[model samples]
Target: MIENIHFIAVALLIALGIYTLIFKRNLIKIAMGISILASGINLFLISLGYRAQGIAPIFTNAAIAASEVQAKMVLPAPQALTLTSIVISLAVTALMLSFAIIIYQKTGSLDATKSRRLKG
Candidate 1:
């Protein structure tokens, strides 16, 4: 049940991001939309490894002995992957924004169609 909800939310986020990226003319908005799409993908991947009633992956002596841990524990790999992806996305977004700002300064406009330095 909860998984379905998460899937739907992620889907909507990706869809909106793509729409913004494709339809928006401003370079900054397109970069922001790409970031949104990356975030949605990260969320979706993280949700895949979620266990309903599981505890954290910390291995305490008491927790180990108590046997309260569920057999269906969430996988750590997906979480780590998501974190790495988010960091990479942040770096990419910053780079894109910096470039966009530079372009705007040089072109005096945010619209991508206005910046044509390579046109022959």
Candidate 2:
């Protein structure tokens, strides 16, 4: 279980985010929850690339012994993907907050329930 702690953390983060999204009634809280969810997903993606006793994928370093080559190599894909996800989530969070600010400005309310413009 110790080896899989990252997975446990990922699940906990995701659950916390979902809980916040569901129970919170403020737009800011919703945006924060979304950001948390994104972070959880990013962590999960990064954890997927973790290798036991693995070396970075740098092959030009002669300092590493040949025997070390037998060890697993951590792929760059997951890191790159996590980076991309972080950027995208940042942009999305900023956009969501901006909209929330605008709504508060126009409607004078931050409550998600009260900010609704449609009624059926």
Candidate 3:
């Protein structure tokens, strides 16, 4: 059903990310691949909290109605965690990109093999 589709999507994203990271020689491409992998994991986590017949997690003090009972089925924790992860991932991506830019400026190349800082 829907679960199988989600699994396939997540698996494909992870596979592409791994391929990009391993096959791309450019640092920026590798960073982008890592970001893709992180995003896929985040999506999988959010999907895990989804219920086909559920509703939002809002509540009121009024007497519970049949509709309210039917609407009180969401899991907020996973959504919150995903939001936090997105913010953290943004920061990490910015930092990594900045470092890559610095490396490129210093060495004038995007290829990791051309960087001489590691040479003895």
- Which numbered prediction scores highest in lDDT against the true structure? 2
Tens-place lDDT digits, model 3, residues 1-120: 865798788888888899989998888998999899988888888888888767677665534676667555687899999999999989989998999999989888988767756776
TM-score, one value per model: 0.87, 0.91, 0.85
Tens-place lDDT digits, model 2, residues 67-105: 776566678899999999999999999999999999999
Worst 10 residues of 2 by lDDT: 61-70
- Which residue window of length 10 is worst by lDDT in model 3? 58-67
Predicted structure 1: lDDT: 0.86
- TM-score of model number 1: 0.87
Q: When superposed on Cα atoms, how far off is each prediction in RMSD?
A: 2.2, 1.6, 2.8
The regions of model 3 sitting more than 4 angstroms off are: 61-72
Q: After superposition, how far is residue 104 of candidate 3 from its true place, in Å?
A: 1.1
Sorted by TM-score (best first), the order is 2, 1, 3
Q: Give the better candidate number (2 or 3) by TM-score.
A: 2
lDDT-wise, the better of 1 and 3 is 1
Off by over 4 Å in 2: 65-70
